[model samples]
Target: MAVLLGPPALAADPAPPSAQGPAFIDWSGPYLGIEGSGGASFGQHTFHGTMIGGRAVPDFKTGDATGRNDRSRNATTAVGGLFGGYNWQTGPWLYGIEADVYGANLKRPVASTAPGLGYEGLDPEFSVLRAKTDLYGTLRGRVGVAFDRALVYATFGLAGADVRILATYPDLAGGGVASTRHDLSYLGFTLGAGVQLALTEQLALGIDYRYLDLGGGGRFGLGALPGAAGGPVSTRDASFTSHQMMARLSWHPAGLTPPPETEGTSSPDDRFSLHGQTTFITQGVPGFRAPYTGPASLIGRQVQSTTTATMMLGLKLFEGTELYYNPEFSQGFGLSRTLGVAGFVNGEAQKAGAPYPKLRSNRYFLKQTFGLGGETEDVPDGPNQVATRRAIERVTVVAGKFAIGDYFDANSYAHDPRVDFMNWGLWASGAYDFPANLPGFTQGVMVEYNRPEFALRAAYTQVPKEPSNDVLDPRVFERAGGVVEFEERHVLPVLDQPGKLRLGLFSNVGNTADFRQVVGLTQAGLFADINDAAAATRRPRRKTGFYVNLEQAVSADLGVFARVSANDGRNESLSFTDIDRSVSGGVSLKGTAWERPADTVGIGTSMNGISPSHRAFFANGGVGLLIGDGRLRYAPERALEAYYALSLNKILTVSFNYQLVVNPAYNKDRGPANFLGTRIHADF
Candidate 1:
C-alpha cells in the first residue's frame, strides 16, 4: 500500500517592498499559514548486511531472508508551517526576511536481501526486508530582492530535522515476525530562486524550485536473528540530497478597486495563460544491434539517434480559446545507409539490399492540441466585454484533443508499451481556479482514447511476416483492439496556506477482438474459437489497468512528491499467454540546485518493477530546469538508473545520464552489451 502527503507551506503574507532599514512601512503585514506539496521523487540507497538476535541461536541461521541486493526507493511528504514578517516598500524595490517552523512526514525507504539468496536453505518464515524514514523540522531565513509588479529574489536559511526508520523482516512460518525500528536527527541548509509575474493588481501566478542538503557520514545498524550469519555488524553511513520545483497561482482580496461602469478604454487586456511542453521521437527501423553488413565485415556497431524539436507558439483561438501544435522526426542515417534496409521479426533485426525498399524509410512524431475557454480579471471596466464579478471569479472550463504515434510515459518500463512503436489517440480536458474563495489552488479533469494501428494488431497475433502475411492470404488474422483512457487531477489549498497541493489518478482499458481470418493450411472448422486454434489464429481479450500520482510544495523554494502506478493485462486467445501485472512507487525533490538566479534546476529519481520482463527490482530519475525569461524555455538536467536481475544470468547494473542540452546522450556498459544512445523528452 502507498500513501502521498500534501505540499509545504509558504509565508502567510507577501514579502515587503524593501529589505532596507526602518524607513517606509508601505508593505508591512502579518498572517498565519500552512502548506503541503504534491509531485514525484526518485530514490537511490543501498541495503546489504546480516541480521541477528533471533531464535536461530549463535549461528544466527535466518529464515524469511530477502538476500537480494540493488533496489530503488520512492516516497512523498506533507509539510505544515507558520510564518509572518514586516515589509518596508520604497520605490521600485521589495525585500524582507521571514521565518517558519515546519512539521513534515517524509517517506524514504531502502530495500535489500542477504543471508538468503534465491531462498536457498531459506525459510518462508522470514522472506522480506523493508526500511522507511519519517522526518520533521524548523527553518529560519533572510530574503532580499528588487522590482515592482514583478520581482526577483534569493533566500537562505538553516533547518533542523528528526528521522525515524522502520524495517520489516517477514516470517517464513506462514505469518510474519515483529520488525526492528530506529530514530535519528540532523541539521541541513536550504537555498533557491523564484520569480512572480503579476497579471493584475490583485491576481498573479508564479513558479519556484528549492534544494535541501542533510549532513553526510551518518552511520546506521542492522543485525540478524539468533541463528543468522553470526549476529550483526556495523554498516556504512547513509548520505544524499534532494530538490523541489513547483507552479503556483495566487490571488489577493481587498486589494483592487472596482472597475468603472460602462467606461471608455478599459485596463490593457490583462491576460494570464499557461502552456505545456511537447516532445516527439521517430524510429524508422526496429533493431537494437547495428545494421549487419556483408558476410565477413561485422565491424559495425549498433547505434540509434533521434532528431527532436520543441517550440512555444502563441495560443489563442477565437475570443476565449487556446490551440498549439508540434511535430518531430527520427531516422537511422548511418545504419540505414550501410545495410540498405532492415526488417523486424520477433524483437530481432534482419537486413536487406535495396534503395528504399517496401519498408517505410521515414518515421514521424506528431502532436496537436487546443482548447475553448475564457479567463478572469480583477478589473471589469466597460470596454472589457467579457467581465464578471462573482465571489468565485474564474470557473474556467476547457476542452481539447490530442494524437500521438506511441503513448508511452517516461516513468514506465524502458521498452515501448506495445512491442511495436505505433499508436494514435485523442483527449479532452478542463481546469478551473478559485481566486476569491480558495486563494491558491486549481481543479482539473481529463479523458483520452487511442486506437490501435493496423500494423500493431498484426504483430501481436504472431503474423508479422515479410510481405505481411495479410496481402497474399486474406485469412491472416482479425484486427487487434483499441485502448480507452480516463483521468482526473485535483489542486487544493493547504488550509489557509501560501503554497498548494496536487493529486492525479488515471486508468486505461484495452479490448482485443478474436482473430477473424487464417492464411495457410487450416480447415475452416479448425479455429472456431481463438482459444481452440491458439497456435495459428491467436487474438486478444479485454484488459484494464490504472495508476495514481500525488505531490506537494512546502514553500516557495522547497517541496516533496510521490507516485504509484499499476497494470494488469492478458491475451486470452493464446491460452492466456501474455497475462501480467506490475506496480511501482517513488519520491522526488525539486529546485535548489544552483545559487545564481538563472541556474535553477530540478533533480529526481524513483524505483519499481514488473514480473516476467523483470527478474528482480529497479530504480530511475530525471532533472529539469527553467532557462528563458519568464521561464518560457525549459532545459534538461540529469537522469539516473540502477537495477539488479535474477535469472539464467545474474548481474548488478548501474547507468547514468546527463541531459545537458535539449538533445542528451546516454552511455551504458552491461556485461557483453555496450552502446551509445541519444534521446529527448517533454511533458504537457
Candidate 2:
C-alpha cells in the first residue's frame, strides 16, 4: 500500500472498537486473505502440429489413455493464491467484488531415463507430451447471506489461465530430437460457493469450492526445435476445467467489533500491508574449449536473460499471529538451461524454465510468536515483516510455503543473490540439499527461539519424491527434510563492530540412490545402465550435512562473510547442485566515502568439490541436476565473482557483474570461462 498511501511510517494502531461478541455480524468492509487449495483439472489437450517427411496422421494424438484426441486430460495439483475485495452489507444480505490468482504444480516427472523402463521410460534427452497450467486467475462478484456470525455465499466470475504444452519427437532427417512447446491463453467463466464463520468482527475462517471453465481456445506455435532445423514444427491447445477446494483466513480491515486480545506486545491494529519488487538480469558467456559435451554440459558460447516480479501481501490475524503471501511472475532461462556448473550463475532463475512470464504464489505462510518476559526491539516494516515492537527473547513458529534459505544460513554480505553475489556457491552454503520445489520453495514448519545474543531454529519440509522433480513427496513427515541451526551474535574483540555466526545441520530422507551403489550397479552390469544409474537404484535413503556461515563488519560501510559447508557425497543430489563440499567467502563495501552511500561493491569466490563417487558418476556418463561433463579430469570447481551496484534511486539499483569460472564442472580439461551480466532491481 505504499504505492497509494505513501511510504509506511510507524503509525500506531488506534485502540480497536470494544468487542461486541459478533452479536450482529458486520460484513460490509474491505477484506483480503490467503488460501490454500487442492483439486483436479480435467480437460482436453489437443495437438495442433504439422509433421513433415512423416505420416500424415490426423492430430498425431498420443497418450490420451483412450488413444483418441477427443478424450479429456486429467491432472491434480496443490495450489496457493490470494484474494481481496470490498463488500457492502444491506441488513442480512452481503455483496462484493473480488479477484484472485493461483500458481500450480502440474508437471509430470521423468523418474528413470537410465536406458531402462523397457525402452519406453521417459528420457532426459527427449520428452513425451506434457502440459502444465502455470498460472490462472479470476475477477468475480460475490453475494451472500449472513446470520449472526455465519455467512453463506456464492461467487461467479470471468476467468483466464495460461497453459503450456511440450513434447519432443525423433527428427529422422536431422538425426536429433525435435523439441516443441506451445503456450495457450484461455478465457472462460467460473462459479463458486463458500461458507464463512466470523471468529471476531475482524476475522473470519472459510471454506470455498470453485468450478472454473477456461474455455477451449487459441493455438500456439512451437517453432522448429533448436537442434532439428528441418524437423516438423508444432502447435497445441488446451481446454481446462477444475474443481478446487480452498480454505481461507480473511481479515476485515473495517470491523464492527474489535478482536479479542491476549498477552504479549502487539502492533498497530493495521490489518494488512503490501510490498513489491522487480528484478531483471541478463548474462552471457564467451567462447571456451571443449572437445565433447554431455547431457548437462554448458555451451561454450551463449547468452540468456531472466526476469522476476513479486508482490508481498501480509495480514495480521491477531496479536502475535500474522500471514503473508508472495505472488511472483517469472520468465526466461538460465545460461545453458541452468546446467554445467556446480555454482551456476543466476539464483533468480528457477530450475523449472518458463518460456514466458508466468504468475504464481511462491510463498504463503502463517507465523505465530509466543513471547516470554524480555526486552523489546523495534522491528522495521519490510516485505513480509510488519513494523512492530517484538520481544527480544521469544518463541516463534512459522508454517507454510517458503524458501528454506530465507530463514537459514543468513549472511548479511553474501546471502541475497538478487542484491549481492549471484553465484549459487557464493550466495548459499552450496552443500546443503535444502528441500525445495521447482521454484526454490517448499512447504514446511519452522520454529525459532530468539534472544539478544543467540538464536536457535529448526525446520521440517516436504521433499521431492525424485531428484529434481517438481512434485513433492506425499509423505511429509516420513520422507522429508529437516534442518537445525544455532545463530550467535557477537562483536569483534578489536574492532568491536557487530558480527554473526550461524552453524546449521541438515538431514533428509527421500527416495534417492547412493552414487557409489549406482556406479557399482552399472559396473556389475545389473542394470546395465551407465546413464543416471542412480535413477534405477533410487530408494529411501538419508543424506546429511552442516554449514558454518559468518559475517563480520569491520567498519560501518565494510563487511566480510564466509561459508563452509559439506555433505556426504554418497547419495545423488536430491535438490540444489552436485557439489558435495564447498567453501565460499566474500567482502562487501558501501560507497559512502564516494558520496553514494546506497551504492555497493562486492567481491567473492568459492571452491566447489564433489566426492569420489560423484566424480565417478559423471565419468560414467551420469547426468546430475547441474553438472556432469561426460569425462573426468577431476578437480574442484573454483569461481571468483565481483559486482558493482549503483543506486539510481531509493528503490532502484543497476549492477554490473563478472565471474571467472575455472575447471568448469570440476573437469580440469575445460579451461576457465568468463561470465558477464547486468541486473536492474526495484523495490518499494
Candidate 3:
C-alpha cells in the first residue's frame, strides 16, 4: 500500500553557539522547499463470508484452501513533494505552521489456486491490488526548541490523500475477467518528530520520521461475478499505515537579503540563487489503422499522462566559477511506455519502468568562465544562470553529470519541449543519436568559445554500458560519444531579422551490432532471432552523423525553424531514436493580431527514414530501441503537429495540441495514427 505525508521535527544535536548568543539566529520568517522520502509499508486485506438472500457465500482464499488467512504484502516506496511554512520564535522556544503535499507509488499483486463452485477441479485465480496515492497533503503545527544553528521539534497534523484501489480477478469460472475499483478521498492523522540543521541563514537541511494512519478500512462488498450464486463477495478488513523517513531542504527568500556587509565577504545575491518549473501533460491517440502489431507498436484509443517538477539550486563558489544541482521528480508514463516510433512523441518521457512517481538527481555540474575582453551582455537570473554581466567573447568549461542536449543544438523556436514543440524530432535533430542513460542524461565535459557573431562548442560524454541500459559504461574513454558544433549568427538582408545557423558533427564508439551482419546471420539460419545475432556480433563500432539547424525571426511576432540530419545506418542506433535521416520545419505565431499577445500558435511537420539495411532488418522482425513492430512493410515515417497555447498568467500556461503520424514505425501495413493532447506548464 502507498502512504503519503511529510516527516516530523527533531534534531540530532544542538546548534553550534554563536558569538552573539542563540538570539542572533532568528527563527522567524516564511520559507519554502522540497523534500524526498523513502520507506516501507505493512498492511493486509481480509475476506469474509457473506449471507445474501438467506444463502451463504464462501470466503475467498489465498495460497491454499486449508490454510486461509489475510492477503498481505509489504511495499517499499519513494515519495517527494513541495512544502512551505512560517515560523516565530520566543526566546528559546519556537512555533510554526507548515503544509506539504506528496505522492508515492506502492502496490502488490496476489494469486492463488482454489476449487471453483461450478467447476469440479481446482481453478487458478489472480488479483492485482494496487493503491495509487496520487497526492497527499498535511497541515501541521510545530513546536520546537531553537539552538541557533539547529532545532529539535515534534509535530502533529491533519493529513489527507487521494487513494484508489484496483483489484482484478483474471480467471473466473465463467471465462471473462472480473475487477473492482474504488476511489477514496481519505482524511487522516499524522504525528512525528525530527531535527533540522541550518547550513546557512538562507539554506537549511533536515531529516525526520513520521507515522500515519488513514483510518477508513474495513469489509466492503465488491459486486458479483457473472455465474456466481451469492453475488459478489467482500473483504473483511483492509487498512493502511506507514512509517516514513524523509530528508528535506528549505530556502527562505527573505533570508537571501544580504546582512550588513563585512570585510572581504561576498554579497548574498552573488553567492546563491534558486528557481523551479513544473509541467503536466495528458495525451491520447483516439484511433489508428492497425492492421498488424508487435511488442513495440503503439496502442490506439488510450489516454496517458505525466507530470514533472524540477528545482534548480546554484552556488557561486568564486568570481568566475559556479556549481549547480537540479533535483527532479517525475510521474506517469508515455503512450506504450514511449515506444513504437522512431521520432517519438514526447521528449519528457523516459524509457524507464511502469507508470509511477520517481525522484532523481537529474543534473549537477561545475562551470568556469574566462572573459576574452569583448563587449558585455547582461544575463537574467534563472536556473543555472546568475543575474550578472558577461563578456560577449569568452571561454566556458563545464564538467559533470548533465545532458548533452542542454548546451548543444539549441534553437530559439524549437528547442525547449516545455514551451515549444513536444516531438523529439522537432525539438532535437532526430538522427544525432546522442548518448545518454535511461533517463536521458550523461556524465561529460564541454568547452565553448563564444563571440557576438559565432560560437564553437565541443564535448565528450559517456555512453551506456549496453545499448539502452540505465548504467553508463565504466570504460568511458574506450566507449564514448563526442560532438562539435559551430553556430553563426546573422541578420536577414531585406527583413533585417535575426537568425542563426548551426552545423554539428557527432560520433560514438560503443558496443553496437551491424544491421547487415545481423540480417546475414539470420538469413543463413545461423541465428533464429536478430537479437541473438546482435548479441553474438556485439563489438566496438563507430557511428557518425551530421546535422544542420536554422532558426530565423520572420517578423516581430513570428518565428520559423528547420533542421536536417543524417546518420550512418550501417550500425545499430546506440542511443536516441532509430531514424537514419530526418528533416523538419515549423513556424510559430504570436496572437498579437487577435489581441491576445500572451497566446501562441505553432505548426510543424517532419519526415524520418532509415537506411535500406536498417529497413531490411526490421522487415525480418528485428527490433530497435524505439521502433520495431515485429515485422514491417517499409515506408518513411512522416508526422504533422499543431498546437495553440494560451497564457493564464505569467507563471502558468495551457495548450491544446494534435498530431498526425503516417506509416508509424516506418511500417506501411500499420497505422496512420492521430493523437490529441493538452499541456499545463508553470515556471517560477
Q: Considering every candidate listed, which one attains the maximal TM-score? A: 3
- What is the clash count of model 3? 7
Model 1 ranges off by over 4 Å: 1-31, 39-72, 78-92, 115-131, 138-152, 170-176, 194-208, 222-224, 245-684
Writing each residue's lDDT as its tens digit, candidate 2 over 199-296 gives 44466656566778876754444555333234343333445676555557788888744222222333555566667766667788998888788778
State, as a TM-score between 0 and 1, how close model 3 is to the true structure: 0.71
Write down the RMSD of candidate 1 (Cα, Å): 23.8
Report the lDDT of model 3 for residue 681: 66
Model 2 quality (TM-score): 0.66
User: Which pairs in model 2 have colliding backbones?
Assistant: none
Q: Candidate 3 lDDT, tens digit per residue, 85-169? A: 9988787688999999887765554323234434234344344344556677889899997543556678999888776666555
Q: Write the per-residue lDDT of candidate 1 for residues 1-684, one digit (tens) a residue.
A: 010011111112333446322221123233233333332111223333323332111112334233322233433333444444433434435566545554554555454334333234544344233433344343534344432233445556665556555555544444545456656565778675444333333433333334566554444655443223333433334443444333333444333221211222223242322222212121232223322222211122333222211222333334443343332211112222222211110011111111111122111112122222233234342211222222222222222212211221222212221111111000001000000000011111222321211111000112111111211112224322122222222334663223212222222112222222321112355544322343444332333343333334444544333334433322221111111221222222222343222111223332222232111100011110100011111111112222111110000001122211110111111111122221222221
In model 3, how large is the Cα lDDT of residue 545? 94
- lDDT of candidate model 3 versus the reference: 0.73
lDDT score, candidate 2, position 33: 91
Q: Model 3, poorest ten-residue lDDT window? A: 1-10
Candidate 2: C-alpha lDDT: 0.75
**Each prediction's number of clashing residue pairs:** 75, 0, 7
